[model samples]
Target: MEFKLNLTQEQKLIMTQQMQLSVKLLQMSNFEIQTYIEKELQENPVLDAEYKKNDNDKAQDEIDYKKLIKHLEFDNYGHSSYHRDDEEVSPFNFISAKKSLKEFLKEQIIDLNETDYIKSMCEYIVENINQRGYLGTSIEDIAEELTISQELSQRCLEIVQSLEPTGIGARDIKECLKIQLIEKDLKDENIFKIVDEYLELLAENKYNVIAKKLKITVQKAQEYGDIIKTLEPKPSRGFYTGEETKYIVPEAYIKKIDGEYHIIMNDGTIPKLNINGLYKKIINNEDDKQTVKFVKEKLNSAVFLIKSINQRENTIYNILEKILEIQKDYFEFGDEYLKPMTLKEIADNLEIHESTVSRAIREKYIHTDKGTIKIKDLFTTGISRVDSIEDVSTKIIKKEIQEVINNEDKKKPLSDQKICQLLKEKNIDISRRTIAKYREEMGIKSSSKRKRF
Candidate 1:
């Protein structure tokens, strides 16, 4: 009786290779994703990182590529765009140098389907950007040096401006911050004006002066100042300087466009992946079992990798879409408008498991006008409002407490209890302990230490 085999059906969860790939991809930071992609490109012949022309059209490809890129190559990742016919390119080899600001700009320039003249102009403009990430010379000087019209030189500078490191080629700090704000679709707004003209006043903590000039409240001025402070004055801050570089590549961009928010994946960091057409042709024409089987396996792996990468990106996009829909006011206005949100809330709304949402945002970042913030920062606990049934985000509470502390009389800074009472009067009821906790979390010293006198 014990020797009999029992046939029973039971449900069990299994992680298929593709499922495992997706899970791994969902949690990888942007640099990790790039490194993973580079590895795949090296190991999988079927996965093409970019066009490597067939031998038949190699001559034509050389001529076309020569117009824009003059032997473009990266010194690390054992990767380079230019290859000799006899050279063996290895993906497994690695060094540590990342692409510099100029190299990064030139890559995008070559990819642009623009005329060679325009490409050259863009390259010249990129070259002119100083280490501090500002255009070291005036547009007039560039035009004279290039023997081109000032309008054309300005246009070329604008092209560089449109590139990543969002404010590249800016002439001054005002333009640098303004360009970033514009990338966020915040042009000519209160924050933009504050950055454009009142930067010095803001630096001096002249909120009332700015408020009087802008016809807004002092609190609003302070809010704008906070947001402006988050912007980068030096667009080249994280760029490869002479030392070893550890640059942060943003996962996505949150842009408010035409009265609606849009989620744009940062495709610039991740190379476009394509299943090699040559692999398909070989599999169809080859008769050897070993050759066909090897091609088929690689092709399947390439397809799965592409699918997993796409699934990861879409999951991130969906999460951000939901976040934007819920927190549109925050993006348009300020952090105080950020609503109560959590991973569970996003999972429920997106109709997915909670961990999926969590992993999708793990170590991920979004480039916002406020700066590159962790996507995980978007999900926060709620603190109930005193006068309404609705809730406020802990982020909003923290910002409010910061503003309160910042504006308190330095000679007699407000204590935790007094801060709590002030917040209560404003309908944000919280205990002194919560206020103290938030203050500490924000790195604000105790009120006694905060006393200026």
Candidate 2:
């Protein structure tokens, strides 16, 4: 009954389809973008992948370099700029997708010379093993859950423990280490004893007490502790876990050129997108109205996608460049030299919104001459320095705390307050409570827990 029209002045920030596309492109990692481009190539009739000789050569060089970098980090790694005949090189060789750990274990289980019933039980137990290679359930609980005897469950667990990687199906860290030790067939019984009874003490650096109890020298105990440190704590570390584990491809690399750091973005993976000439021709002919409209729509989408991807690349490049400039010391030296930076600071410097910077960096990573690091890792909240006018990074303060605690007398471990005093003396203005928080964050034990003979 009442049809009234009222005019009110209102302003709203609305995201258009193009803007949404741009944001999505910005948020996606390099791997994600490659996948997205592949999908777009399949779905969009007007979109085409352009691969020229120059691009092909450049991409090949980058891939070789990438392999070299991988080799440095892991085993069987090498890179060569040497070009071979194009016919000899297979494109499929570039595919580097890894098999998941569950799949890897399942294949071994299939080949196991055991009864089907027991194999099924083993499979069930394998399912219960978490990503960190620790059994998620107790043998009793698993037996009860499966309505089986504890004996059968225990046998299956032993079989799982016997599998490769040497430490799979371990219920805890102690079991994991012990499994590895037995697999190696270490002649020393004292190491087994230490794992069995004194893991907590061992972690606290109580080697002297361990040596005295085991009738061994303190030096030997220290050596055993060092050996334990070398064991693979996570059995599935080198291999893929599952979808939960993100395979990171660095978006860019910071290479120091003549003492100046330069960014080398991994854009080789991204297909150079182009409009299909046939589609453009179809539009240019202007024959059928319906055909023209359809082609125009698809062409608009293709153009928008190309524009959005370009914008995304530019935004990420700008943010990373700013970060490199700000974190020059960290790029040059190491993690301890990192300056506390905020998203807001980078956004301000780049003349963009803080949220824009955050979105651009979500799931993004950069490779440095030092090491590969997440873009977010460069940002930390700063704390004021007592004597110096400059603020100190909480990361730096944590490093300082760790260094002091490391060099302190083990029998008389520095308390949080004492650590705070030591930091203050070094001009890091931080409270005792904050120090404790940072220490806990770094997984350092409390003073009492850290004390040893």
Candidate 3:
């Protein structure tokens, strides 16, 4: 065997430490960036943070204290006031902590007049109910684990199901809906039959099949489907999850001034950074070579950090400006008017790579008059219509599909094919399969399931 060595020249992209930091900072959310800044502040002695004064603080500072004091002294100093009997404290004001679904269920179990043994069993069952208000363990499993009979465990489950939310202990979605229906006194022999036997058909929007089986008119079947739609599938849906709610802090604000959208970067939360004067003096003194070298290195790091933060802000601002230009209709008219966009489009416009655009918008949010929205939500793939030269956004198509379904006749609910045809009339040339895909994505049932009577 022989080994040969040859000099090879090739160009490869290399990211420096500062470059990596800039990329990392660009992708971080406002909360994450704040935490990172706090950590960096602790570690970097040369780097200092300057916080901006809040608007409320400035307003309070501008208040006339002498006038306020005079008004308070004259109005209330010698006056006798009676408390209004009708003005009671809100119950919500007394609540210091939110109860999880499990805690709420356990509280109900405690109030039950059942024996301690049954209550313990009920408590155990409640503990196993997942965040979705469905039992995580089977009755047989619970019975074997707790050394209780299946009958007793089943009764405990029934008791738990009877608790508020109407379907806490249901094994599955069908049982959940059935329990809700029963509670509302809306359950009949046919409703129970449809829930048990024809749930799949109901989901497919096959009202005709259901009507034929139940020997009822299409309108009557539609009534049953409508009633089912009113039931809450997710009974535990508004209860607090164990995890804390994440509130999005917007990095930029888009405001319409004189019928034109303007992009403003929010630097309010970002700390103003500068190298400590003492550290700069230590570097310039040159009295201690070692000390000078250390201070210089730290100073360089601090400068790079400041530059990276600025670069992050600039990149985000440019990206949002381009988005504003492209999605002007969305900004003016709302989500329904959102046009299809892509990372590549923004990257092309800004003369940056697709990955750069993605990083710049990742985990970042923008606030507009419409409300706070994720930066990524502004970009969607397009579906072109046959009649129109311009493309339609998938989001817009989904919204249109929902509208078509919402306005549809219950007895003659539009199937995916019919939906595709209807969309075609509006210049949306999508396939039946694509229509079905979009329909399902919006959680709409099939023609079979949609049929009523």
Candidate 4:
């Protein structure tokens, strides 16, 4: 074969800065959009804020309630409720906002006249708490991070565990319970023996085996077990200041109206902005060529920015439209109706790149009558086997394990193998190791640790 010059017609896609800007805007949250606008205003002298003419504008606008009501599409569920009252309070209690576990622990550490280094280590340990109040990191990991000795890290960890929630800095459930047991200094003489020797059996609620091995009565072992349950599992949870907690402001709202789902963009909360009239006038006015050129360039840039914002809004609307179409059942029924979806699926459906779909949904949300949900939540990884009745997400699996463990007879809790077998019977097809992992993720102890009288 001889080489020949040949050209073929093919689709070519290139990501330009304009396209990038549009994507960036699409992915930005409402707060982020405001910040971007503010930054643009500062940098571009031509972009200026349009202030309301105060009471005069309001008084004249009173005649037309439409001016007061932002342009929100009213659905059959009643006109999209817009609060004109500036005094509308947040649903969350502002005054009694709980302190984060890290800050609360830090406050206690401040009273200790230790060196800054030790204080810092304590803070790090507190910050790494898992949901159930375990440190979730090894001493070696902490030492490596801080470039400090493991001994020092352990010391700080010990101090943190000594705080109000007894097991705050434990590495695992066993350790967490052990710390609590050590703190309480209970009369259960065989507590340590039981924890070590029968933790796995205990985890399965194998109280009969535990009592037989420890030579203790079932009632006594249960008494000790009950004491362990009273300890705080997660010490660091619920510690955000009201002001610091970022609320999810949805970009769109989906409502069920007349036995049908309807979608609306939530542009009501965002403030409206336009090109500054003064700058537009200057651009239009005749001036020196250099001045005119500079003004025109800046004006073009501003227009591009506005166009990007508009494109971002349109892309979000289109993506939401597709999601509503695909997940119509979920909106109507609830989570159980959510079919497994992936980024690739949406990309294929919309004829957009996968990354574009990812960017479109990133940090974006849809407010439903149920609540504000992140767009990402709509896409779930499908389970390997499609025959299972249970939801395929690991979270759902973990929850089931937790529920099983929670209700297990203290004398006979399920073992990892048994849990795996049970899940298999239910078509979950999880291995014993996977069961163990789910158990750990749920902050559950092993069958031995779970053993009671």
The CA lDDT of each predicted structure is 0.83, 0.84, 0.85, 0.73
lDDT of 3 at 223: 75
Models sorted by TM-score, best on top: 3, 2, 4, 1
Error of 2 at 176 (Å): 7.1
What is the clash count for each candidate, in the order shown?
0, 1, 18, 26
Q: Per-residue lDDT of 1-453 in model 3, one digit per residue for the tens?
A: 999999999999999988888889888877788889899899888888999999656754655556544545444543532222333222233247988888888888889999999999999998888878889999999999999899998999999999998988899998999999989987478888888888887776677788999999867876787788788888899997586888889998999999788998888888899878888677778679998888778888889888888888889989998999899999999888899999999999989999999998888889999998988988999998886788989999999999999999977888888888989999898999998888888888776566555
Over the full model, what C-alpha lDDT does candidate 1 score relative to the true structure?
0.83
Winner by TM-score between candidate 3 and candidate 2: 3
For each candidate in turn, give its C-alpha RMSD to the true structure in angstroms. 18.4, 7.6, 6.2, 10.8
Residue-wise lDDT of candidate 4 within 179-293, one digit each (tens)?
8778877656687777666777655666677678788888777766666657665654455522466778888889888888878877654555667777666666785667778
Put down candidate 2 lDDT per residue, 102-188, tens digits, no spaces: 778878989999999988999999999898988999999999999999998999999888887779999988889988988788868
Error of 3 at 332 (Å): 3.2
Model 2, CA-based lDDT: 0.84
Q: Once superposed on the true structure, which residue ranges of model 3 sit more than 4 Å away at CA?
A: 1-9, 56-96, 115-121, 139-153, 186-190, 193-198, 207-226, 258-260, 281-297, 335-341, 380-410, 413-441, 445-449
TM-score of 3: 0.77
TM-scores of the candidates in the order shown: 0.54, 0.69, 0.77, 0.59
After aligning candidate 1 to the native by TM-score, how far in Å is the CA of 212 from where it should be? 47
